[model samples]
Target: MRKATFIIPAIVIVMAIIMSSVFIVDERQRALVLRFGDIRSEIEEPGLNFRIPIIEQIVLYDSRIQSLDTAPIEVTPSDDRRLVVDAFARYRIIDTRQFRLAVGNGGLREADRLLEDILNPQIRAVLGADGVTSNTILSSDRAELMQRITAQARVLAEPLGLDVLDVRLKQTALPLQNLEATFARMRAEREREATDERARGEEAAQRVRAQADRTVVELVSDSAREAEIIRGEADAERNRIFAEAFGQDPDFFEFYRSMTAYERALTGENSSMVLSPDSAFFDFFAQPGGRAPAAVPAPVE
Candidate 1:
């Protein structure tokens, strides 16, 4: 009974020691074995791993790609325009030993801080460089600027065992204080453009109206000239007809002319005229055949 108790206790102690010394490294993880605060081994492959019990410690780190979102940072471009930039980075822990050495016990949290430090300066340097205006940052050219930032950040972060795979600008915007002023300037510019367009339209309309007015005047003058020509021609035709008729029959022509003259002279409802009955105006009236009366032999003087 005494031997059995000792054997069971020995087996239990051995099992406990084996459990503490053995660990499983997941496929997505990298493991480090440390002894007396010094790294003794790095386990990259996933599977069973062993460490000295009670004297060695194991630290596991995720080996997958990770993302870090930086705080909004303000930068001034070459043009002195201030902008707020929000950025993010995709990274992976490439060297677990180097990462642990750099960040100590703080692990991923400290690494993230170091990464931000590296990223912010590169962002500022590339975005605020000469000729890199706020307009450039807000345009498609911003992609190139992000690439520059990523290249620079990769260089700086390599020492921290971080591989900065990609960096991107999440949002780029004018400062809150400048937004209203910018909007006002844009509104003013649009208003000026609108006014110019309206003025051009009015000028075009004036030119069209002037052309139409000139056309109307020319048409009226042409019509008046044609009417005058027609009237003159008609008068000449009438005079020729009258002359021909008179040549054909003087007595009849005289009678017709006398009738027309009387019709014109006696016009209104209350028309009155005073003339001697013996006047030549009554020649047609005195002779039924429209012949003038033979002059009576003048009294012997």
Candidate 2:
């Protein structure tokens, strides 16, 4: 009888423990309580929660930040250049009820896939309104584009209860098919500009050098002309002074110059001369009177 009583109490205690088991919900979770494998249609906040064991289940949801990485998208520019654009998004569950009804727990992945299709076209549409090509847009306009991508994605996702916080472009570049052609064009343009700039610099340097050379020629020619004039003037001044000195005794100067000429012309080792005793040279050699010159006056007795 005592054994039967112990067995009955043990059974009751085990059933109570099973029925009273509770789940702890942290600060970042929102959950749905499922009754008999069906959602109870009410969402619960974070706290200690109880449910019937073996008959009910807790479906937890992430209420904090979450991320979705999208596949690379292909976009064309105003100039028809193609590029590959990779994007990502930051989102959080804002309205649990709508999220559950619209996406369900299993539907988030499918929703993300849907988001990719929706956001890319929006990106293309906005980008098509721009003046730049895909390559330029990819290079310099990434920040503006990222904001646009997020804004467009938010518009598409906000109605579905997933609040898209931000969208970002992870990578952007020309499509592999167009990579070589685009890069070659860019390189050629840069090289052509460099060539033009170098040509301009060389031309300027040549002009400056030419100007310096012309100035040097002009200066040298002017100096030579001035020196010639000064030399000519000095010669004329010397001739005038000599003429004035010779006027002091004209006949003596004439005789003295003639004697110097005779000495120079006749005394040289390679010289020969012929002269008459009565030649004009005799006029100077004769005595002061009209008489013929006497023999050298016998030792000046």
Candidate number with greatest TM-score:
1
**Model 1, span 1-301: residue lDDT tens:** 9999999999999999999999999999999999998999999999998889989999999999999999999999999989999899999999999999999999889998999999999999999999999899999999999999999999999989999999999999999999999999999999999999999999999999999999999999999999999999998998899789989997777777667766777899988889877766657667766576532221221
The runs of at least 3 residues in candidate 2 whose Cα sits more than 4 Å from the true structure, single-residue gaps closed, are: 1-21, 105-108, 130-142, 249-301
**RMSD, candidate 1, Å:** 5.5
Cα lDDT, all candidates: 0.90, 0.74
Taking every candidate in turn, the Cα RMSD to the unseen true structure, in Å, is 5.5, 7.3
Question: Model 2 TM-score?
Answer: 0.74
Task: Output the lDDT of residue 128, model 2.
Answer: 66
- Please state the error at residue 286 of candidate 2 in Å: 13
Top candidate when judged by lDDT against the true structure = 1
